[model samples]
Target: MSNRTGLARVLDDLGTTLIDLVRGDPARAGGIGGVVIDDPHDDQVLPPRALVLGVGVREPADVRARLDELGVLGAAGLVVRGPVVLTDEVAAAADRSGVALLGLAPGASWTQLAALLRSLLAEGEVTDSETLGGTPAGDLFALANAVASLISAPVTIEDRSSRVLAFSGRQEQADASRVQTILGRQVPARYSQLLEARGVFRRLYRSDQPVYIADLPDDDGGVCLPRVAVAVRAGDEVLGSIWAAVRAPLPADRELAFCDAAKLVALHLMRQRAGADVERRLRADLVSTAVEGGAGAAEAVRRLGLTDQECVVLVLALADSHVDDPAEHARLLAERQQVADAFAMHLTAVHPRAAAALVGDVAYAILPTESEDRALRIATDFRTRIGDRVVVGVGPVADGLTLARSKAGADLALRVLRAGRSQRAVARVSDVHSEGLLLELADLIAERGDTLTGPVARLIDYDLRHNGNLVETLSAWLDAFGDVAAASAAVFVHPNTFRYRLRRLAEVGELDLTDPDARFAAMLQLRLWRPV
Candidate 1:
């Protein structure tokens, strides 16, 4: 329920737990716009009031130089690894630059710090201004802290899978296990196994009362603190749990209050879930409209916060979504949603303005960049990370109003990949343009109910009636550009045999293979036709 914002809010939440103020006043920086890692090798556009993580920066002089540089860029704060040496020059630089300086705690990684800051910032991004019990809707950290104050202990809010969602401050006061959980953002597997063996989770979930556990033996043979846990439930559905590290069992009155807190927690959890669903649907609608490109497209793009920026469109689709079993189809559908969510998170982390949404069976991403090569690299990395279950198609970069053309290109490339015509799992439109064109041609012919004509049709008919290999031989020859040796090798036949079949096909179908125009027409037909 703290009304702190920007640098002050970050300090209030994470200070002394994962970071400490090294020098300068945090209040000097008004509001933090975004979190960005400082990479000296690559140029970056620092959003206004950015909090830059000075990873690998240790020297006092380097810190001062970065502070000065960030000052001109209007950055809010700079965080470097501890123990930071407080020098007069660094202090003076911070004072002159009007930027706050902080240090990440020892044993805490730069990655962990960045994640914590971003999570805190994302909570503020929720458009809802509603509050539950004076706590902002979905503000789990504030709720966790409030619960900690009531219980007189540090606590963690965890999802059903035992993954830590949010944690209260004073975590250092807790045991080593609790600190480990906070650091890793999940209950360790060994601890979960021990609890499962004890039937603790089963008992906790079976009842609405608080479950208490005595001290447990740690991996180092040391005794850990006791804990009290209560499930957060909405009706009969268990949403998550709130666990408090305590020295002794809670009294009856406090236990009643703890149970009451679970009810409030349930409301917040449900609100959070519903808000996420609504946000996703809204984003999908905006992306769908923007990519369709019409009078409404400009407004949709602006609403998505992508106005006036060059962007590359990417389409992602499952390589194989078909299954005979109903249950298996449901599983695939759930997996698609999971992949889309992951993709959206990944793109957002890369660029704050990046947008991704599940539109129909395909997930479309609008990356705010002017380089198709960079877009291809991002797609390739995602494809590799997700394994071979998905394929991504990258389109040419386009401005906001022209996004439809980019989306069309991406759709064409994705269609080619999904058709199993290409060996690649990720491709740009330029890389698979020919294959995409053939697919378009197939679609056109199918729509028009066009049947095969000319020599190629005759060859297909002759092969079907006579059980001959003439069509295959002609396809191979055209694919190899009339190279008899290569075509024969490709079809696993002797050059002489291949030549005999080719000549027979030309004679029987009345095809003038020697003529360039005839060769082109036959090749085009073969490219468009798929044999039954």
Candidate 2:
């Protein structure tokens, strides 16, 4: 791959010399120094510091076939001598196969070709390390390839809204543009979700750490089913990510290696991004400073031509992702790079809190460049893909002083979604309920048996005896016992015997059976208890 390695070039030059030595005759010496053979399907033999010579002596077809068979062998060179003629196509093939060509005069000895090669190749040698140059990473194309090679993880470098900046391996595995097309066309809601999730991507970028999640192929929209994800980042800068959706999953070592690769990629990207940042920093910084209400600094920023309000500076985070080991964040993200690229556009807009993705199934993006319209689009769009399932919320935009508060509202909305299965996938700040009767009821259930064990005592005992078969037992008991026959039928005994069982009812019923609170508490405990 280096310019200094001219051995291949030399081989071509050697072919011409040999051909001239033979006087275009095939009868005297079978080509001694060069001949060509090609076999795409077969791996020809190659020896270290060796030469190959092929000789063709038959009719044109036979000569070509023979040349092809032997020329591909990595030989010092090939030679041919015979009663034959060479054509343009035949000569080209010989060069492509690395065969040096030689032809002896009709009555000449083939020894002449052998002597010729010995003199030319005896001086070949390797260049020293000092003469080598550094690898170039001056442009995006080189950087992308270098990143791909370094991380060995499927990853995509993205902008704030998770828009694809650069990525590798997608061409052969998946077409990212096709996905964007589908998102832009068939499912606009999902596309918006990805944009909202951009916040999540930014977090990984700024922190230069990996973000991990599960089953979010298009973090902006697609539901790949729950699977692990890892995203990598650098201080306020995002490099890329690596992901795997293996049905059986990857082993620990491979996962760790992925994290390491992500870190390496982050370092590389940071170096490049810093250079770019320097080139654009003055304009960006002035605008960003003025946007946060620094009117006094307006003069400095005005030169960049960006008005204060138009400048939006945001710290984005990838939420709704969970990683088993926080330490492996970088590696995990690198492994999932391909997936990240696929959904970069939408992930950029997610609220941050929902970013705890790897645990169960929630990913949040922080929308930095606030707007009511953009927020609404993200919410509605997110709903369509993650389904009416899961809560996707957008916080009202706020100036820097209260930006965190906006996210807090979105977090509350997500909480409402988690509390029950009936909530819509996308929610607005107005719909969130932090304090309500249902929440109180939920609170009571959430308290576990610590405060209300008496109510669940009998239910608990029943479960203990049946290997936790509460549903079946409840169904059977209600059918067999009726309102007043309860304890008697459960034991297959007479009514008086059941009255004795009823003695504990008042104490157990202290939870107020008539209250939805009590009913919910009872239901919750029964559902979660798994006694072995």
Candidate 3:
């Protein structure tokens, strides 16, 4: 395929020797699809995507009129001469029309630029020269350096969000902006602000072709370097981008080489993603085996490289919403799992001994902690880092052998949170103890029904038959620990009336009202069994 680049890049490659007095928003420069050398008087036809407008000197009115014509023809940008006096009306028209305005150096010839661009546009495959001339084509750093050498510029590989992944390590060509971006592994906020202002990110995400940013100025209009970037994609999915900083437009050969290198970069990203998926599956299997109480559970934990830790705390997070479509649900589940793996990677980066897994839509982490405080900190960090998509549940610290119990605790906490039984984002095992126990008991009560608790069942039957508040009064009395006034107030009834209800309950159920053991059983039953 023909190597495609953005207009901004084309300008940068041209350099000050060939171009000067560039006006209009540099950020709005479109992806250059072809070159259009305008005849002095003939009609001009704009090309698809983006096209470079080449013209000789024209009056300001003519310039504005051409801009209008280009805008109507859906032209991406325009290119003109520096000596061609640019009027405010023309500049305003260019800005309003979203056409990138370019002015060439006084001595620059349109013919030279046209020849250079057309040749590059026609060139196809790029041969590897430097690191990949004789060496294998698998090393990522080598690929980056090779592309840089081919283009005679500093190169950096970045993801879609402009995060610097690898650089060619060209110290001589590195500027303040490049240095900071490499060191921080992301574009600096100030630089990002300038690019964002011109809608560069929006255009980058939308276009598959290379975006050329020429002489990008700082937010304060300070001189900035020029860069050419092309998205590394697999079919329709954009994986990352390759950037090259150059003083002049890349030669046709080098432009072809950069395009070829992009295909390799796409392969690397796809392999990386596949490897991560395999790692997640392996880690999840280990965690599942450990939590399911297998004889090899300790072996599995050891395989994860966790040792010399006093305790392991388990944390689980579950997605709050569900999707009905199977494909979409699976995609969402995969995204969630990727998020969980990233969480695990973050934990390991900080603590070295932490491990995590994704079980369906739920995420689980087994973190080695020195103390309760550290575990709490990890839990808090998780809550802050994972954001609002999932509800977190933290289990108490336990030894590796008892990891299953901790996992169960976390699962219970997650269940409670999902059921709307808790308001906190990070629900701890201790926090959900009462609710968890009640839910477990409720399961057993539901399975056994009336056979499990005769007295509570009798009271429930009596209330159902008479439409009375006997069950509520009894439950409130037990909840208040046998306090008459508190229980009466809880039921919104007079103390004397509650006392009379208690007497009637005791007589109807044939139960003792004074025995503490019997009262405790009744309290447990009341908490578990649903009243009729």
- What lDDT does each candidate get? 0.88, 0.42, 0.68
Candidate 2 vs. true structure, TM-score = 0.29
Tens digit of per-residue lDDT, candidate 2, span 87-158: 666666555554444453343334433333332232122223311113232222233344445444433444
Better of 1 and 2 by lDDT: 1
- Cα displacement (angstroms), candidate 1, residue 146, comes to 1.5
TM-score, one value per model: 0.94, 0.29, 0.63
C-alpha positional error of residue 353 in candidate 2 after TM-score superposition, expressed in Å: 21
Q: Which one wins by lDDT: 1 or 3? A: 1
Per-residue lDDT tens digits for candidate 1, residues 1-532, read 1225577778777647678888878777876888988887765767788899999989999999999999999998999998998799999999999989999877776776777787778677654468898887888888898999988889999999998888898888789898888777789899898899999999999999999988688879987899999999999999989999999999998898899999999998998889889989999999999988988999999999889999999999889978899999999999999999889877866777889999989899999998999899888888888888899989899999899999999998998898888988999989998998899888999999998898989988998999988988988898899999999999999999898998899898899999999999988887788655
Candidate 3 per-residue C-alpha lDDT over 99-118 given as tens digits, one digit per residue, 9 for 90 to 100: 76677655444655565454
Poorest lDDT segment (10 consecutive residues) of candidate 2: 351-360
Q: Give model 3's TM-score versus the native structure.
A: 0.63
**Candidate maximizing lDDT:** 1
Model 3 misses residue 241 by how many Å? 1.7
State candidate 1's TM-score. Answer: 0.94
Q: Which candidate tops TM-score? A: 1
Where's the lowest-lDDT run of ten residues in candidate 1? 1-10
Query: By the TM-score metric, which is better: model 1 or model 3?
Result: 1
